[model samples]
Target: MVWGRTEEGEQVPKEARVVFQPGAVWPEADVHADSCELVIVIDGTLEDENGTYPRGTRISAQRGTSHHPRSSGGCTLRVLYPDVVEVQRPAPPVAEGGA
Candidate 1:
């Protein structure tokens, strides 16, 4: 859920509570060009290309950074985004030995 805006009429950023089931894979995506993202692990474990994060872990993804998040045993995360981020999905792998 997104938080309320600031008294000055500026946005207070967006927040989300995400639950990832076992074997869940979140696609790799770039952080918004003008915003950074913060993530806190609440339970279980979350893994990305950089490393694995367990409960109580805090992650800061700067603007223009990318990550592919997944969970092997389920996880809960609190994510904060400055604004709605655009996802950039990776290109599908080409099939081999076929036309």
Candidate 2:
């Protein structure tokens, strides 16, 4: 849920609680172009290209960074999007064992 607003009168979401089911993958690619994102794994585990984040782990993604997050065994996350975010379609999955 949105918890804050910007000075320019925009409804900026300051924080969000996200629940991921088992083997769930986020559909969009989040590009933190305007602000950084702070992610806290509240329960279970969250994973991205960087690494696996377990419960109680806090990750600070700086501005201009990007990530496609997913959970292998379900998880709850407390995400803080400090400002605007650029959402892009997720990259096509790579084929296994080469063409």
Candidate 3:
């Protein structure tokens, strides 16, 4: 459960999202952007080259930082985003003169 939810119990803007995908791991995969983000294991286990994160573990990742999140033995987590980012621009730009 996210304590960062709004009064309506909906996700607030810039709210951190905790992904609780059991038995899911992406080796050497860093996903995210230039925003405040953190990955914490509310229940289960997770680890990367940096260190091993067990249950009740919290990790802090600043802006512009990236890490490969890997979970062993499956887990659930609480991700906190101090700031939310609006993905405003696409990676590739549209044709210059197209309306």
The most accurate candidate by TM-score is 2
Clashes of each: 0, 0, 2
- List of clashing residue pairs for candidate 3: 14-84, 16-81
lDDT of each: 0.79, 0.84, 0.64
- In candidate 3 the C-alpha lDDT for residue 95 amounts to 84
Residue range 1-99, candidate 2, lDDT tens digits:
655554455555677899999999999997776568899999999999999999999999998889999999999999887775333347999888956
List TM-scores for all candidates, in order: 0.67, 0.73, 0.59
10 residues in a row with least lDDT, candidate 3: 1-10
Candidate 2 structure lDDT: 0.84
In Å, residue 10's CA in model 3 sits off its true spot by 18
Better of 1 and 2 by TM-score: 2
Could you tell me the lDDT of residue 77 within candidate 3? Answer: 72
Q: What is the Cα-based lDDT of residue 18 in candidate 1?
A: 93
- Against the true structure, whose lDDT is highest? 2
The residue-by-residue lDDT of candidate 1 on 1-99, one tens digit each, is: 765343354554467799999999986564455457899999999998899999999999987788889999999999887644334347999989967
